[model samples]
Target: MPPPRQSIAHLAERQFGVVTTGQLLTLGVEPSWIKRQVRHGPWNRLHRGVLVVHSGPVEWRTHAQAALLHAGRGAVLSHRAAGYQHGFLDSPPRVVDVSVPHARHVAGSPGVVLHRRRHLGAEGWAHLVNRLPTTCRPDTVLDLLTLARSDDDVISLLCAAVRARTLPAEIRDAVMRSPRMAHRRLVLEILEDVEGGAESALERRYRRDVERRHRLPRAQRQVQHRLGDGRRVRADAVYDGLGVRVELDGEVAHPGGRTDQDTWRDNAVLLERGDVTLRYRWRHVRVTPCSTAAQVVAALRSRGWRGTPRPCSADCPVT
Candidate 1:
């Protein structure tokens, strides 16, 4: 067998250069030796019982490992931390979120958020990422929605996941089946809208604030059309009977240059077919929905829509 020092080094390498005092003791290293190494050697203390083998610049994974070690047994990375680990988040987690069994009494630390779960060890609740235990992607998304501060944040996260094709169908089903989850009703409603083809937060806002709120006729979302050159194109929203199309120009949907050209080409094709297309940007849809509704109403009326536009509320300007 290799020496105890070699064994410890190998273990630390596997764990993002983090090792616990208990792990060192289990490797047959003397307590005095471990203390001396931490005090005088390259090892740096991260938590009460956890030490990083390197004193140099630490990576994001090192922070995760240290938080997991400090959280003790039966704990898994969760929430934003799990989102980051699973590539759902654009940036590294600011604070580590760890879920421990309800029976365990792990206290909260400076850089760690502790969540107690009654059935954390149940099958399918947790999985491994880079050798570290973490909540499943679906659970992480739900947890994030619960922890979200505003409806816009929740919608943004859901839209990001959907745009990246990382939001699985099972996650939506799970949320629907879970009746006791916090914000369950709101999440289910959003999931229903998403399933109905609101692929981005901007599209969802248009559907809600501009269409439903103003009492405008419902338009088909993501309607595909065949161009003169036989190229297939999907319009953001289409009113078939009225021959009117509403396009939400979200940044993710119409990334500049090539996509812009494609959008212009699609608009020309629709216009040639006697369709009226109204294109709106993020600011137009989100910041000024009343004005957007007015424009859509005018387009729909010109295309023979007889339904009168009504204000969403007494204060709404759509009327």
Candidate 2:
């Protein structure tokens, strides 16, 4: 029989000190040796057959490794767990998410969510990230899309995932792959806007809720202006000839001294052309869109814009 160090110990080192009873048996380990380790206090049982080699604290990675072991062959980290793994999500999920083949049955345990998917494998849909199986970048993004609670969540999720790793085309292809996915059309629409320069969710909301819904004058997107220093800058939304520019700020708008750079561009527009700029954040654009539309209308009118702001609906706050 092979020694424990040569077989089970090596696997544990690679898998965050986690090993399965099935794996240990395959490596020629006796059954009582596993039970004795658990009973002796050097090891702990995390699930039916999954064991952690150390008695120390169990971290997130260790929990994830244990969950995968319990799930057995052809199971992968998916949904929120995969999103965290792919860098698409901002934080780690409290519950570990795993997907197993629909035909394969695995009983669930506490703190682990098992997703039974029709086509589950390490094929194109999944990838090995840091020795753990996770859904591919695009598939992870898609899974989060279906799981989003609101339209804003969908937009934020798409923008975040797109900026983090996967290309816009990859997202679209994943959409095509899942024909009957929940919120498929909504995802496709948001994907289109993201590809068309709606880089942030706040910007997309401004276009849909404040501008289009209120019937505000069409604003050209990403209009370029050459500064006196010969450098070029692009404004988010511009009303050409009227000299009105609108800027949209998401939660993390100005980072790494971008505020100073933005001020310089605003000064350039104000000094060179005597134009006015309006800036809005998530609250102005998302929470109170009609009020935001009114403010935008007043700014455009002050700039000699003749068009009148139209109320989006009968109950719209805009007059």
Candidate 3:
């Protein structure tokens, strides 16, 4: 090797910089060396001392930069940033949020959102160690709930949170103890309605929108018609002898890594119950109740059960 790699830049190509003053000194790169590098366009200064080596695609460090700039010295990225890292949100947040322990609120910047919590639980908060835009899952869930626009939005966020087993008990407690949350009757109802697990919420939402809205008869959830110890496949919704079974189709229901797996499962359910099964989607349940009801009624009529969905204010808006 040529002279045994003398400097920090020589050691790492895309360096996030030395973690401390001591590391910088150990690397024999003084404050002058950093300044000279930046001045010569060898490194980009992200914060006071954190320098990133100029390289191909230095990553979208919006959150880390905001955290470093907003929280001053020792703030590691957490909450929404962490959520992003953990793959919770589908899109990156427009504003980078930083959590500082102090009570001072820094004036806002164009893309910086600073949060000061007096006491964020340190136990679970250590997940962000050495990670940019990192946050504990609990805090992330709470932030999503606070920021989500609609009940469906909240449901979507919570469903993900629940699936990840990251929805904290503290969040549940915070919702229950808050007097203000009581005013949001729909949110409260949805929150209370979340039982069993994330799959349960998906099932419940499908039942509420598809079965209850269309005046379809209630189908027993997770019913197993199979005999003892034989890995009974649970029907999502079972009408028993009423000639209808509603199979709530979620992503987990299809496991072959193919869309055809879903079709096969639906067909299997239908064939098992003499083709009386009605399948519904997770997202379109609320919005497409009319079409879903029409399908169910058509199925019922084919089985010699005459019934029509009553026209109501719930008639879907023409889209």
Candidate 4:
């Protein structure tokens, strides 16, 4: 009989390196066969005893895959890693994070980030379609909220999560049940603050903490309000009560193709309204929504509107 086919060729069909000894045993390949294959350069050792066949470049599986291999039987992928796996983050994270039982610290490998917590309650873990483990939406959000430093960071993340719809209503409700009820409330407030009000990123940020928080008179967003020159200009937001027209100047909005004409048209609108327009960029709108809102509120007050500066804080009463 032909010398048993080279062990290296046999395992390559699966397309991932990093296999356990038990897997080899199940392949009906004897222990002596494995040793002989290793000694004869038919396989390459990746981790301690974790073997890779020698026919191709060493393949790097996802960190989740590596973690599952390391944790062996009990661990599940979770936290930021699971978020990435579940399409929570707008972009993939640079690191691999995994969650294993508190029973013991699993051995580490290069680029494998392990998080050990006793809180892997049943809801925290889920199988990723028979692949590496992952965390459900609620647990992932909870993990992020627990670790993030500022309310702003949490809000930013929450906006993206809600937009992605990875955070279902049930997951959001579960967050309220956690010990951080106050923070959870704040997150929900932030989520409500941003949803469906504005179309662009900059406009959403402004509408959430600035327009709504300050109780500035409402504006017709993306509406075509015409100027005397018969030029029709669609302002980002137009508050007729304050005669204050707010425009979120973004590259995408005024992409240089027709922005100059649009700006000239906007100037026409301002002149018709007797110079009562306030234009803002992303930086001013995002960093200091309160201050930006204050400016807009003051301008609105000038136009015979009455209001006080309303704190955007969750505890603040309606002004």
Candidate 5:
């Protein structure tokens, strides 16, 4: 039979190089033996009762596993940690976030954020990803809502999730399931905007402050076009009932200058279809929204749209 040390190492391999003292003891490894390894050998203590089984390097997974084990059984990764684990977050978290049953009290550890969940046992929202127990993706989004420092932070997370291909229905259903969610309305509104193909805050700003506020006709989103060279492209927004298409250029896409692809789509798709499009950036939508709305109304009028654009307020200049 393999020795207790070998047994613990085997178990740690399955846990991203994390091993709990209870696990070592269960394998018949004495406390003194564990001490010797931590004191003078390859292992390093991550928390009070958790240790890294190897000495090469401790990555995010290792830290995550150590946090989970340190929090004991029935704990799962949550919030930003789960976001990173679920492949939506761009970077590893500075502090590992772990969620445990509200009734369970795990001692606080350095570099770990503990979230107590009331329904973590029979109705717990957890599953395995990359071999570590974590909150479900939608639930992770909800957890993030509670922890986000600002509205922009929340929006950034949701946009990142959308970019990572998380279904809107899934997040919406999660919101529905959580009736008492703190940011429910804001999240739902943003989700609707994003699902309507407003991929950036700039696009959403146009949809809200410019189009809706000015009473412009509802525009189709992500309108796809098949070009001459068989290249399929999608426009940002298109007015179907009226012959107007607006191409939103956000900051993230080619920040320095416009792409040739945009020109090709504009000429081949918009002009050929006899649709007028407006090009606007962050400043136009955010700084001079009324002027932007006025331009859109003029474009719509050029396309034979017999609609009057309303000023957003008494002081507004949309007309």
Candidate 6:
């Protein structure tokens, strides 16, 4: 006889329509009935002993459920999978990443990446999303940082998480507490930059390439200024001594009319106050950073800055 549909449905509902064969057996379901359901009924097998309770399309949630079930007990969604669950990732993960105890040996599959961890049992690191166990937002950030391929990738993810308010205070605590994490020094430096008002990848790039790399003096970031009409504007980076302000346009696409007008108005006010502003785009900072730094150096020089620009690398265009 088939297992009671009502009981199975209740369990599947909580698990995104997925269930392990072990769960069914524990619920008094016969082993033969479980195989029969997959053989002839609406049930679809996702992994070894893991089945989707319905015949519908396998969505992201179903994949997550299957991965967790296949990893056995104490496995939680992690890395890019957890980033998606925390609403930081733009799309559903292509590969579901699940974390298991360091001592547990789980067979890996094409669609699932299993991570073995010795410290995953700590409190406040795991939470539930869609009834699936996942790393908390802070932990997810740290985990994703490890998987980042480049410094740009790390900055992009960190800025996006911070902008979306998904990154929590505990992220810093986690980073500082974990002495074994790879890229710990770089991660700490990026966190400090973000906390110090480098809120976008573009802004961070400008700081790294245009200012620091070129040996330009440190400028106050996100400096607030008030217009004659009481409108407040924040400059991306401001050199108070040189009266030179730098604006970073990070958007790849052109701005709308209103944004353009606001920029024009803000520029007019700043110009009236004798403050010189220079604007740089995303490509300017990332692609031809040396040339971009030269321009900034020129602007500062025009404003009576006596410091000379220095080359960051041997091939650096800036002299």
Judged by TM-score, which candidate is best?
2
- Ten contiguous residues minimizing lDDT sum, candidate 1: 252-261
Pairwise lDDT winner, candidates 2 and 3? 2
Better of 2 and 5 by TM-score: 2
Q: Which pairs of residues collide in model 4?
A: none
What clash pairs does model 2 have? Answer: none
Sorted on lDDT, best first, the list reads 2, 6, 5, 1, 4, 3
Instruction: Summarize candidate 6's per-residue lDDT along 1-319 as a digit string, tens digits.
Output: 6567789889998888899888899889999888888999899888888999888889999899899989988999999999888777878988999999999999977699999999886888798887889988888888998888888888888887887686535667888878888677877888888888988888988888788888999889999878777877778889987888887876632353236655775577567678887877877899999999988888888889899899988888777
lDDT by residue (151-176, candidate 1, tens digit) is: 77778777666655656486777687
Span of 10 residues, lowest total lDDT, candidate 3: 13-22
Model 3 lDDT tens row, 1-319: 2212356555443224323333456666556665676788556554454456563444546335534554564454655665666666655666667776665555555455677766644556635433453556656666656677666667766666665665545457556645464224554555555554335456767767766766776667766664333434556776656667776665554433336754665566566656466666655566566677667667666676655555445544311
Q: Rate the local accuracy (lDDT) of all candidates.
A: 0.83, 0.85, 0.57, 0.65, 0.83, 0.84
The C-alpha stretches of model 1 lying farther than 4 A from their native spots are 1-5, 30-33, 160-169, 176-178, 241-243, 251-277, 302-304, 313-319
Which window of ten consecutive residues has the lowest lDDT sum in model 2?
249-258
Report lDDT (Cα) of residue 60, candidate 5.
Answer: 93
Off by over 4 Å in 5: 1-5, 28-33, 55-57, 149-170, 189-200, 241-244, 249-260, 270-277, 281-283, 294-307, 313-317
Candidate 2 whole-model C-alpha lDDT, 0 to 1: 0.85
Error of 3 at 207 (Å): 2.6
> Candidate 5: RMSD over Cα atoms?
3.6
Task: List candidate 6 stretches off by more than 4 Å.
Answer: 1-3, 26-41, 164-169, 226-231, 241-244, 251-277, 301-307, 310-319
- lDDT of predicted model 1: 0.83
Error of 4 at 298 (Å): 8.6
Q: Report lDDT (Cα) of residue 267, candidate 3.
A: 63
